[model samples]
Target: MHRLIRRPKSVERDLDILSSIDTKGLISRRELMRRSALFGAAATLSTFGGVLSAAGQEGGGKVTVGLDSGAFTPILKTFAPEFKAATGIEVEFASYPLGNMYDQNLLALRQGTARFDVFDFWPNFVGDFGPFLTPLEEVGTLDELNFNDIAKPFQQLNIYENKIVGVMIDGDMFINTYRTDLFENAEEQAAFKGKYGYDLAPPKGYKEYRDTAEFFTRPDQNIYGLVEVTSFFVYAFFINQLVQLGSEKGVRYGELFDAEMKPQLVNEIGEEALRRYAELTAFMPKDLAQAMPWDVGRQIFFDGRVAQANWWTDMPKGAADPKISKVAGKIKCARSFGDVTVLPYGRAVGIAGNSKNKEGAFKAIAWMQQSAQANRWVAETFEQSLMDPWRNSMFDDPKSTFPLQSESGFADNFASVSKELLASPKAYLDISIPGTNRYLASIMQHVPRAVTGQATPKEALEAMTAEFEETTETYGRDRQIAHYEEYRQRMIKQGYWS
Candidate 1:
């Protein structure tokens, strides 16, 4: 037998009035906070109360969330209590390693275990887990979730088969981070122009990027020209170059696959992209073949040992932090080399299809992704949270901009470059069809072989192409074709392509 606890009548009345005031926009968030504090409602009410009421789950309950271990673990834990206060709901998290998170979540969802009410995962995983996830629209209205405030590129990421399946939580794209001190030095600039017959600045094309990388390689001084993730996830780097190459040639869908669902990676463009990617190894760390993005690649840049690195959006925040970075105040950001940039590994949150409390779960997700919360997360230093700005409001909000502004122009440069990248017609979406992980794994396997000289670029891509076909066929070629076509259509609709 269980005992039921209830809120006092006065506390319940205060919460109702607070919820009404918030819903009607009678006060600003700060003012609401002030009023709640004055009424002593801060101990029992949170801003989430309105969202819970909107979801028709204003009563108390508990929902379990599934999350991968990392920066998000601490953030969610810190906010859980606030959520509980607002709606009288408890948030229990089941954390898993990043690598196994997909498998674990998939297993539980498919098993109908109701193990998790919400799942926080990479946007691409929506393809594999769509069947087991609840459509967000069913739980709350778009306005209630503040859906339109999210970035355009990430908006498409949260949809599956024309239905809203998730809420964008982390905005991610590969951007170039370089040593400002090196690039601004007059001697280096003149020497670069004399040698390369072009101005010394951030690279505008692949050839220029290669030239820049080669020109900056000074191993004796412990400074390398370039570094990027080159390990198991090297596929992301390869795809970035591949998409840029395809966009340059004005090919649709970045030439990843054809209308017939045949992979295009065995062609001349594929070989060239692979070769160009492998060529950069000469100017990178000798152990580049096995380097992971976060551990080896980012650490090298933060240590001021790399002249330039193309990494995730969070790189600038880390670079600006004096506590963990040797390059603080000396770093500058630019869009990755190309007419197009690749958006990769962004995370989103979705309610589980098997959840007993879908409304409660969505309320939790909405609360986390609300503009104020997202802005706060973006305002925090990278060491505090890995979340990047995913909402338009976050970009313009003073709270979010002030911290980055104080970092000596990092905020302005990052915000400008990020807005351009996220809104560009040349922005390429990562493949998010079913079996996306497997297809990318195939690239991960062979790209390293070429980088290590175990195989030629052409040979490595040929093998990867074959494996891609097998993966597509294994999942049923016709079915995969439809999924890819649907995904392409969404990308085009979202202005990612023509």
Candidate 2:
């Protein structure tokens, strides 16, 4: 029946399992037999090895960790070896796509599978999965871990029911990553200022951002002014956008959601705030009107065909790699456009509720987040550090091995922003309202329609309100009202509404 191929991984010392499922009539009998024999050998060895490992761990042995595939792979590859050498403890890591990983972990925890010792948690779902994540309070004490070194807001973001559940391992700031070479030209700058009535510098607020986008846009030249992740809450890009633009929110971006998983805005502030999304999208690439945030949008921006763009910390590497990017050298980092209160995306590491090897998993996470390992990973990965607060402390330090900057003190430029993030409180924005996942999805889908003039702001807000109300009602009125109340307070403080 089935043809199999036998192969051994020369370097890793692992057996390969290969199967030839296709049985087309094109191949001769002798060839088929040869291929099948090879396949069968490899499959046999692979099965035998897998059996031995399973038998070895039948009772219990090591900590199993789940990581989101993609960038995390490179990060672990770079740091795991060092941690293993230093501690003599090895962490078994399982990688999967973001959606699949979360679902698998969720099911495993619910079924008490104990398939994972540690799991990655997102800020939005951190609260949702609180019941399933092992509270750090039950395992390792934070005091001994020097929890104070963790930025305050970020620390708070990980707490659920007043107990810390997740520790942010990497910090990601959202800002405009633009082509400096394009903006540096005097003629381009003059024309931009003349058309937009503002200097051709970075956008400070929503209006300014739009003006500049329109000014630089030369459809006939195949060049556009601004390129941003066109998602429903690209409006939330306004979260950082607002702060970077000099409009301070009532709550710090980091502290938007608190321990209770309640909305932190003052009133229906998100509604009006979303209006800016409707306006700004008018100037973005048309693909945003109906494309996923990470799909093709980033690739286009990194190609250098677009003038200015916005994204999280990892965007640099995405746009800078020579193989994948054309405008790498032109990309320059800057302070986020709108708010002073920095809201960094959190990469949290926590023990799984059903983990069998709690101690082992904690050891791995500790090693991963520790200053030395995290610093090295930051340097190697170039994915901003949420664990290390200093953006540039390693520039001249002899201990610093990362080759981020050629000259000394260049990192100091990031210090102010880094310090602000670390010092600011971590807010629970993404997970604040129940059904936020759907709400955010709806925003991503509908907001673009409104932004591109397919729907009016009032129409978008009305639809959002209707959906928000329905989702809240599904959760219960009392809970919804309570969240609205807290949100109202936050808005009043920020001056969104009286």
Candidate 3:
């Protein structure tokens, strides 16, 4: 994977945009929201109508939010006009490329300039923004919404230094998406069974997965068995396997660190995970080094060039879309792969403590997450977008899968598999705390080296362990150990360890 901090994330480009807009003068609420009828604004209009009616006159403000230029953009862009019309808050937004957003948001928040009111916050980076973000509990929910409604894993993520720094914004977990066309092919399946002594099907575990990958590698037919990805996505692949391998091998890495906060990333489990990851590189496209960037691999798979890849659960929506995917209607999702099918990821958002319009920002968030809007985001899509659902309500709703089902053609299959996997006992959660980013950066550096053959998996992990120790020392081992202890307690309370 490339470095965690892809670039400087300097806001020099943002400053140029800032200079053009007059922050000193507020735009008239009516004028700003005048174009509210964009993107079937029906769901929001009635909700905001009463608020606008109560104003009697123009009594609105502006709320600028920020997002990574990924999933948030399409939905946010569609909803902005309605939010503006309802609250009289001119919605101004800025999006950084997904790779650079973490550092970009950090620069903006640390500089004490609330460049955006409502900003996207990933759990892993929430600790870094502790000083600058308003705790969710401190602000209170918009309509007394129960914070308990979100899944326990996600709820656990928002707690930082005993405070709720962010709220879950999207539901994400990795799962295997493979072309059913290939797996179910009679000739291919028979050949696979003959060769590997198993039916050609979705892998129940990494071992079977490797065998399946090997059976499908046919470079001459211009078809690759898997798509290898780099950067943070690759890290997910490595760590998820490591976590799973730990249990099967009778060495659980579930707790990540021991009671003393010593990293357990250099042991047998780490070596095995790295070895499996490196082995997968052989089945990836021939043009790339080890793997392609996530976007590249995704497109390759959609074009029917690659057979399978482990990616976010939402990938099937794109794979099944007839309009864009060459392999439309041929995708299938497997909920569980014996242990954790794939790693799960969750993102949370918080209002900047220094936000110029916290009230509007809060309202915007509430509006965006409302049932209708949430459902629309799920169903309404012409392309693959982020709008990943996080709420239990969404998961339970039969109607929520329509949009995805429409695109992926596995409406029932996707829903059942996804819900089961999401609630799987083996789901892996990302590390969240002040020093995690730096520690993960240390990992990002060494693990990829091992994958590319510069170092042995054990050697790379040894270097990772040393660097992790140094980072722990730099970030105060005592404090971090306490945080891990606190997380442990939460896991116990929630049965996350069970």
- Residues forming the 10-long window of minimal summed lDDT in candidate 1: 37-46
lDDT of 1: 0.78
Error of 3 at 423 (Å): 1.5
Candidate 3 per-residue C-alpha lDDT over 157-209 given as tens digits, one digit per residue, 9 for 90 to 100: 76777787777777777767888899989999889888888778898887787
* Candidate 3 vs. true structure, TM-score: 0.85
Best by lDDT: 1
Q: Compute each candidate's TM-score over C-alphas.
A: 0.87, 0.72, 0.85
lDDT of 1 by residue, 223-324 (tens): 999887788668778888888887777776365888788989888789888888888888987765455555678888889989998878777778888889
* Per-model lDDT: 0.78, 0.55, 0.70
Better of 2 and 3 by TM-score: 3
- Give the total clashing residue pairs for model 1: 1
| Residue runs of model 1 more than 4 Å from their true location after superposition | 1-59, 289-293, 398-407
- By TM-score, who's the top model here? 1
Backbone clashes in each candidate structure, one number apiece?
1, 40, 3
Residue runs of model 2 more than 4 Å from their true location after superposition:
1-60, 143-146, 232-235, 238-272, 287-289, 320-324, 340-344, 381-402, 407-417, 420-429, 432-434, 452-454, 477-498
Error of 1 at 395 (Å): 1.4
lDDT by residue (tens digit), candidate 2, 12-72: 2322222332222223435434433433343223323233233323333466777777647
Candidate 3's displacement at residue 146, Å, is 5.6
